[model samples]
Target chain A: MNNVNLNEDQQDCLQEIINVAMGQASDQLARYLDTFVYLKVPSIEQVSAQHLSDTLKYEAQSVAVVSQGFFGYEGIRGEALLMYQPKDSDRLADLLGYEPDELSVEEQIIDLSSILTTTFLNVFASQIDNQMSYSAPRLLFSSNADNNTSSQSSISEHIQHNSFNWDTALKVKISYQVTDYSFNCDMILLIPESAIINITSVIDRILEEY
Target chain B: MSANPFCTTIAEQLNTGILILDLDYNIVEWNRFFAIHAHKDAKEVIGKNVFTAFPELPQKWFERKLSSVIQLNTQSFCSWEQRHHLFELSHTRPITTDSHFMAQNCTFLPIETDKVISHICILIEDVTDVCHYQTKLNKVLDELAKANRIDGLTQVFNRKHWEECLDKEFSRARRYDHGLALIMFDLDHFKLLNDTYGHQCGDTVLIETAQKISSLLRLCDQFGRYGGEEFAAILPETDLIGAVDVAERICKEIEKLVIKFQDKDIRISTSVGVATINPNDKRYEDLISNADLALYEAKATGRNKVCSAKEIEYILEE
Candidate 1:
């Protein structure tokens, strides 16, 4: 809509940083789950909070999502999101020896997204030369929640209601596929205008050094 | 960080553990909950590294966790379902819990100083009750799943579940070119027995006959109650001859069954049919139909006998 918020050089730098961070995180997850993790080349965008749901790769399907808020060395803060499509959960639960039920499957996804979020952000923080601290991962949306529980009905409505004070954010998106398994998920980091403005200053410094 | 004295002391006195760790893993502040569990005073361990205060604490894992919390400025979590315990603290309630040590779920809350994180307040809550109930619930689920696959009277696999098992075994046998045999048997005079002595007596005869035949078959055999008075067993890796031998043994076992019910001995006999994967067998249903045809032949020719599909076909050729 508006001209690309990031200059060509700035976008390139962010992409390269995301690539390295994602690679390490994928390796760590491969070891954690003992399954091959195939990562896509990550993309970054600037979008308003209103259009966030539309921009997401997944449609309004009832997806399982885990959200964690991270604070950096400065005033930099953002929420990390992991949205998983509901596929092969029963098979994965059988593989993990968990009860192949809705609750158990949701718990499995939450535990995994925790490892993946921290590992990726830790590397991304080091790349940007900033320390990151986090809020505990929270189950924001669950396909299981609708049938089992009465509340938290829809994901887009959940995101819209929790839209941060700033309307715009720097959204980083990456998807991962578990090789030999039908499980896959998308990881998103949403930094509001204020926090990401602080982040861009750090990005600028990295680019200047280069 | 300034706090409400009322809330601060309340947290200090609460049952759950409340401790604040600096970026270096040093304990900045703690409450009586930690003091009581670790058997240490706040004055002694508050300034020391948490791992140093308790040598048994998993330092490497905790250090990595604290690092992620510090660097990512994010909180992580663990559950008893995952790793069980992070701190080895004992609870006062021994009678309630089966475990000696307490099961704890921890929360690492970042204490921000003008938007920058300086300390992590770790809240430890005892989840022994939840964990125990969850474990109990899981056990019940396992039992329910087992019950769903079994016949209520006979305690053998139900027809639907047995069909599923047969389908899987069919694919497996086809893939590996392995032998598979099906046995279908029916009580010769089941309707007369049920009508003469009531359904209760008939149920007893079925249960006893199922158990007897189950004991005679190999462990790999998949036994199920196919119909009201009919039962089926799938013997993987068993050829036609092996299946016939098993059928004869089962027929003899059922013939000798004298089920005791209401101070009376009820005698019952069964006719068995055997079929193995032949060149003509295409699908699992084909094998089942062949076995059923052999069962019809066994009942028609002579009750309390074992019949094979190949031999019945030989008689047809004559």
Candidate 2:
């Protein structure tokens, strides 16, 4: 199948599953921030690795990107990325109750990303009745040209440099907001083509049971 | 009254200190280890708010953490590196170091009863020794890295570090289309000076020269000892005219330098060569070589003078 397109009903099912996972992730964040966290409806699409940048585009000139991989049985595996503008790194560090230093600032960002990605990934795995193993989170720097022109190409170059290659990817974009601190983050989940077959089969079973 | 015998036994004997706090932040129960380390009796601490017992605690942060555990029913953790200690407890081993306080890693977990979160348990782990050793190792590594970049005698950057800096600045300048300048100079007849006044006087002269040149350069300028009796400076965003101006000032300043050794006043001078980054230069080393050629010209055409790379090239063509 050149294009793996889900029908309207299947798409609705996938979105509902993602909504539950996003709720758990936001609850974790709300507790830490002592504020309510709001998440937008996740949008899902199937695109090639070459078009992954288009599916996951943000307007920030400088961003801190963090990624972690999770594995499930029957050849099911995927990675999630949490990215946000680093302009508020200082304020976020203070809000997280961390000492003001370069290393501490970096660690706080990593901690935030880890908590979000791991919580959401685990909850999704549980809802699907799959046991998932997680890898340590890694931080990556995403920078645009100094002139802020042609950011799309720069982002593509960065993705290519990281050697992320797959025939297809299930791209999901979920935006989170904390109203108190005016904080915004983009959580992008990319499931490889090989894992989609397993996920859809599980969804089919759920449909049959219902 | 506690209802579970096994739970009480584990709490009393566990090495990790544990404290249970009610929703009002009052201490409900504590382990033996917690009581001992805190230097407080169980009878004295129970029913008292934790903030009252430990006034030094970060109340804002602590309250937020406790509220999170209670509201979200999830565990929260803080590393020793993030916050040294939630409670100011004395170090068990006094002889370890001068630090009187213990480093702790704390975890807060919700205690649920009948499907409702009743209390929050705080677990404290002492990591003083590990933290102290880590701090010592980082200090040693920083000192080693600093020593690597400095010349043994002059205390200025060594040749390796200076070249690295120049290469970095060169690329930045080329990328942004900015100007850069290099200055290469050596003492006048340094070999003869060592022969006449002995190597000891020569050492003093080199040390005094390094100090003189360093005081004249700005912090933005990268100054280093290129080799024995030879020095170089890299100036970013400076053109040939600006480089020449700096070279002339250094020449005049060094001409007046007086080195007093064993009741003898020694005088010395330096010949300086200047080169600015030009379109013809492919790399930073190209600038270095051009400046070196200019320095040779300054020495041949009467020492104790300043020469520019373009001037030397013009004279050679004549």
Steric overlap count per candidate = 9, 0
Q: Interface Cα RMSD for all candidates?
A: 8.9, 8.9
Which window of 10 residues has the lowest lDDT sum in candidate 2 chain A?
A144-153
Model 1: pairs clashing at backbone N, Cα or C within 3 Å: A132-B71, A132-B72, A132-B73, A133-B72, A133-B73, A133-B74, A134-B73, A134-B74, A134-B75
Docking class of 1: incorrect
Among all windows of ten consecutive residues in candidate 2 chain B, which has the lowest summed lDDT? B68-77
In candidate 1, residue B309 scores what lDDT? 90
lDDT by residue for model 1 (B1-318), tens: 256788877876799888898888888888788778877766678799888877777665566556555554556676665555677777767697797677878876667788798999888888877778877865665576678789999999999999999999988898899999999999998999989999998888889888888898888899999999999999999999999998988788777777899999888889888999877778999999999989999999988998999997898899
Query: Which tens-of-lDDT digit does each residue in B57-81 have in candidate 2?
Result: 8787678657656755555566676
**Residue B44 in model 2: lDDT:** 74
For A1-210, candidate 1 gives per-residue lDDT tens digits of 233267878788889988998887777666655678888888788878668856442443557788888887977788989987676354665433344552356666765677678778877888888777767677766765533232234334556466445668889988878766777778888887877667767778889998
By DockQ, the best candidate is 1
> How many pairs of residues in model 2 come into backbone collision?
0
Per-model B-chain TM-score: 0.83, 0.91
Computed on alpha carbons, the lDDT of every model, listed in order, comes to: 0.78, 0.79
What is the per-residue lDDT of model 2 for residues A1-210, given as tens digits with 9 covering 90 to 100?
Answer: 453566677777888888898888777766666678788888898877657655344433367677777788767788888887865454665555545552355556656665666567767777888766666565554442232223333444556455455778888888877666677788888888878877777777777777
